[model samples]
Target: MTIVNLDHMSTNQLLPEVQKAMIEAVKKNYGNPSSQNAGGEETLGMIEKARASVAGLINCENKKEVVFTSGGTESINHGIKGVAFANTDRGKHIVTTNIEHNAVSKSIKRLSQLGYTVTSVSVNDKGMVDPADIAKAITDETILVSVMHSNNEIGTIQPIEEIAKITQEKKIILHSDAVDSVGVVPIDVQKLGVDLLSFASSTYYGPTGVGGLYVRRGVRIWPIMDGGIQEHNKRAGTENIFGIIGMGVAADLAGKNMDKRINHLKNISNFLVKELPNYIDEYHLNGDPAKGLPNLVSFAIKYIEGESIVLMLEDDGYRASTRSACATGSLRASHVLMSIGLDHADAQGTLVVTSGMENTKDDIIGFLRALKNIVKTLRDISPLYRKNQ
Candidate 1:
């Protein structure tokens, strides 16, 4: 009855090397990065090195463009608000996708409440935002277009480069919430033609509560947090010295092994897709299987509650998820699933399983075996399932 956990969407398993780096950073903590003292200089040096490492991960030419924040949510807030505030004179209209994370959606809602215009472009059944749709959404008043690089719930990889081209041609700023895509997938801001990109350290094996944003040089953005000048005056607050250092180490590891990890996850995912049908009946795979992150798989088991299935799996020792970690407490259906054309009933039955380095082929097979039994048990008590049978 032992269960295998398959809900590692937030981050990959941390390697021993990463753990060692974090310990070293904790022991080397010197005071204020802005202090004029020698220790301050050392802290500042560490912070700068971390900045360079982050910049290198995204192929950013200038390390000064990267600004550290608490995590992806904070980075998203700063990117959206900072750009919006700085470009108010140009236009108040902003563009984004309907499937964006709450970080982007809530921020846009707040902006709309504040008297700014916002446009949420719709996605197709595959949860993809068409770049042409983004171009059409643009107007003379459009100043920024923010699209996530990948959907968190369904693992749909958006057409960011095409959207970037359109935005660049129109002189509009393009930003991507790459929190879900950065560590698991390869990213290059220059190659992607993104004006701004946001990512978190935890998404790739670094510690939580630390993230960063890449602002293309010459892009004007106001500081969201007001305090002592730090992060080249782009963001102002006392830096999380240890977190930043840990992020540096994690980024280096991610960049070095991204390709191998991606391939490994792909193998694991393919096995799941091939074997899942043997255990469960009448299920739907969410999103485009061909164009998704290697480690993520979202599916809907008809006539069963996602939460019930998650709990059932947990009881057996598995740790799968019902939806985005942010939406677990809510009763409402997932916005991402709804955006991709799933009805409320189908959305409620959705489960998102994302793999990490710690997961293995045997782990997936074990999960499938447990999952099949759980679904069968749940469907036995469901009136709808009985009627369908």
Candidate 2:
């Protein structure tokens, strides 16, 4: 049995080029980037080269705007908490959407515990947040508006550009958790007009445990980590040199191949959407397909639990996810699904399929075929399906 990874959202396969770069980095045994020596200077040069590549990937003019961190979670935490703490004099109110990842949701939740206030805007049935709704949520006390570039679970792309305009006019700092969208889609920080954007390397075939935060030149964000003045004084800690090198390579490749990758992913995504109805009944698609990420498809299958299907599919050599990997082990139905008006049963029945550059249309068909069998077996034993039937 050949195992195919359909859970690209959880993590992506490291590209060979990135792996090679990382291996070379480890072999060199480089010194600290901050030290004033030949070894340090050489290491610093490499870091800057990688930074330039990553900066080019996002179209950031100044490479100094990008700060390396542990991963997407750290980038998010740094961006949200840093901004909240630094701008306390201006205001303590923040705005966000209801369906954010745990990083954003919990970061703001922690702020709320610290006496800061938050207004979480709601999304429509298709999981897209309205820019007007975000505009209405801002107030004189609202210091920041944090929205995600695209949702990981449902793949609904938000209108960050429109929201940026609103925040700019109001002078509120706009931070977007772009972990799922940055490298997967065509992202231009200038075009998006966001003050801060958080992203992960694994989203684009880079090494895990590596990511970066893009802080617009003049953004007022404090350092989350207090120590050495690393990451342009935005983040502290010894850099993950090996992982950063891999991420830089991955970012460069992603920028060059984004168009080809998107077209391939769209072909697979379209195949999945077109073929799913033929194989199963009593199901609905989540997210706005026309406006969503081209690489992901979320399906809410009725009367069957998603985990059972995921496990059975894994046994049959296909790998997928029920929800965000970050939210794993939680028994509650997904807050994202609930935010989009899905009932508990439907929320528990969702299967998220995120494709990568390697996945093909045939892979989608094969997965759907296996899914048909699994859904049938599960539904046959489901009391809810029997009652409905």
Candidate 3:
């Protein structure tokens, strides 16, 4: 059976270009980036080239501003904690939204534990953050404002540029987790006015476990880990040579095919948004449909458990996910969904559909068919569904 994979937000298949690039690096470039030998020189060149690729993809003014990290989580951790610690002399407060990924929200929460005040601003029902609300949240003690460029769960895009203007006017550091937006949409640090930006390679079909943090030139950030001088003393360790090369190739591919991919993702997501509602009894779109990521289509279906629908669809050769955060065999409703004012029950029933390079129109049709059948079967025996009638 042909399997339809729409869980792109979790992870994406490595693109062929990325795979080939990594393979070449593994077979030929085995030297450490810090070495001064010939092999190391070659590897260093490759790393720099990949850095340029990443910098070009984001339209960053300085390639040196890009520091490679282990992945999105590390980038976010460093971005949030780094800026907060570095700028504490200015203030001990950081501001962000409640709908951010676990990386951003949790990191900020950790800071709040360290006696730094972190104010998590709420989003509107559409999962969109109002710039006015952000402006109101800022105060004299606000040292850094970390916001996500796009949400991982609901795929809602935020106005980082507008938020940046406010932070800039206040001379506060602004960090944006652009992990979900890097390859899908255009990103320019200058245009966004973000002091620090975090991104992941997997989001762009690169190898997993390799990402980067863009620190605007002259922005002070304290290194989270200390050891060697790798990553310019920001992150210390032996770099993942193969992963970096894969990310570079992936960045090149994403830059070249961005428009085409965007159009494809939009078509796939648009079809689902328009057609999937027709199959479900009661559902509500969870994000700003008018202005959001084209690769995502999320909705909360009433009464039926989303996990059940996902399992049934999986049995039918379709793979998807829900907003429910599964941990240690227990399913917790997504903070993202709840932040948008969804009740616990509704949040548990939220289905998250994401499109990527591997998807096509045919895949979308197959997924819809399987989804319709699964939702019907699950609702037929659902105790909540029966009682709600």
Best model per TM-score: 2
The number of residue pairs in model 3 that clash at the backbone is: 0
Q: Model 2: per-residue lDDT, tens digit, 1-389?
A: 79989999999889999989999899999999999999999998899999999999999969999999999999999999999999999999999999999999999999999999999999999998999999999999999999999999999999999999999999999999999998889999999999999999999999899899999999999998899988887777888888888989999999999999998998888888888899998898999876899989998999999999999999988999999999988999999999999999999999999988888777888888899999999999999999999
Candidate 3 per-residue lDDT over residues 1-389, each given as its tens digit: 76778888878999877887788777784788799898888888899999999999998998889999999899999999998888888889888998888888889889989999978899999888999888999999998898899987788999898998998898888999999899988888888899999999998899888999999988889999999999778899988889988998999999999999998898888888878866666888988765899898889988888888888888899888885232214567888889999999888888889888778888878888877888788888889989988
Residue 243 miss distance in model 1 (angstroms):
0.5
Using all chains and alpha carbons, the TM-scores for the candidates as numbered come to 0.98, 0.99, 0.97
How would you order the candidates by TM-score, starting with the best?
2, 1, 3
Report the lDDT tens digits of candidate 1 across residue range 1-389: 55465887755556677788878878876779999999899999988998888899989989998999999999999999999999999999999989999999998899999889988999999998889899889999999999999988999998899998899899999999999989889999999999899999988888889999999999989999998789989888899998898899889989999999999889998899999888898889999767898888999989989999989888888888978887669999998998888888889999889888778988888888989999889999999998987
lDDT of 3: 0.86
The stretch of ten residues in a row with the least summed lDDT in candidate 1 is 9-18
Better of 1 and 3 by TM-score: 1
Residue pairs of candidate 1 with colliding backbone atoms: none
lDDT of 1: 0.89
Off by over 4 Å in 2: none
